[model samples]
Target: MTITTREDEERLRLLESVILNTTDGVLIAENDHNQDSKIVFVNEAFIKMSGYNKEEIIGLSPIGFFAPDASSDELAKLKDAIDKCEPCNIVVKTSKKNGTKYWVNVSVAPVSDGSGGFKHWVYIQRDVNNRRRHLQALEEQNKKLKEIAWIQSHVVRAPLARIMGLVDLLSEHHDSEELSNNQIIEAIASSANELDNIIRKIVQNTENVQNQSSL
Candidate 1:
């Protein structure tokens, strides 16, 4: 009996240590099905991540941590999952106590009572601000590259087509009295100049995008 008690005590201590020392933020809240659930427990990681004291967090609603512009649809889906006693995982924009907004990956699951009803819910969240920022930067670069491709394919082709058509017309009508070589040459020069200007503008736009990204 004494050995069994000691082993149980050791296991409890190990479990507590693991929960308190884990890197991911952990929280437990009552699963109030009809109302907003209040936070009851938070781990050390959650306290540090949200920059909130235990007293300030204990009775707060988990929804209070979301950013003002956080998607309503996502919140609705999360609530639906909780109501159904299902696990949910979502990436959301969240805020700290200091009003600084960042991104997080949040997971929630129901903790059921033995009788059948869910007594509580557990939350696991991790800061994903760096990854989100990196992806945004890549998206911006891709947008700029797409614009460059459009200019190359459509804008550049317009002036080149005009120049080619003028050259062909001049060549075919050289003996005819309808058109003069100088006029055709002048038209070609103007189209070439237009193409040159378009190229310069594209280069400038590209350089601007690159410089902004570097910053």
Candidate 2:
């Protein structure tokens, strides 16, 4: 039997340390012929990210971490990529050992031996919950802004048009005195009230959206 020399042991320790200390979580899954892929190795970052000990996670299927309600379509894509021996990148929500869920960007690639045979599948996972939430909030804010713009262009225009017409009537009837001053004044007051109400509604909706975003 060949014994590992001191130099060889030192190299191994360095490699282990490099993998363990990295921020990105790494998992190595053996390509099993008799069954589903089995997780053979996981680094310390993975343990921390998943809140699971190394002993409890090794030999388990990688899919066990997937959220219960995770999209089946995404699962199908992952399977298809594996079947074709192609790399796959997907973002999925996964549960930790403590049962708390978080978003992760998982990248899977096939590792090959020197003889061109598949050896293992390497998965690199990164937490992306904060980025996802930020994007979602931006989308919602955009939608709200669009709603406000629509109200300004369409809803607010009706009352404004009414005011313009009443003023035009007042101007045209000034010399002829066909329309009474009081009648013109009443029309303008009604249109102004309607416009004020529309503005108030827009303000309320904007405040509501802002509150939601803050939370």
- Best-fitting candidate, measured by TM-score? 2
lDDT digits (tens) for residues 1-215 of candidate 2: 24668779889999988788999899999977764688999998999998999999899877655537457877888888888889999888888878888899999898987698876888899999899999999999999999999999999999999899889977776634666778778989999999999999999999999998888
lDDT of 1 at 167: 84
How far does residue 78 in candidate 2 sit from its true spot (Å)? 1.2
lDDT of 1 by residue, 142-167 (tens): 99999999999999999999999888
Please give the lDDT score at residue 77 for candidate 2. Answer: 80
Cα lDDT, all candidates: 0.86, 0.86
Worst 10 residues of 2 by lDDT: 61-70
- Deviating ranges (above 4 Å) for candidate 1: 31-36, 63-69, 173-178, 207-215
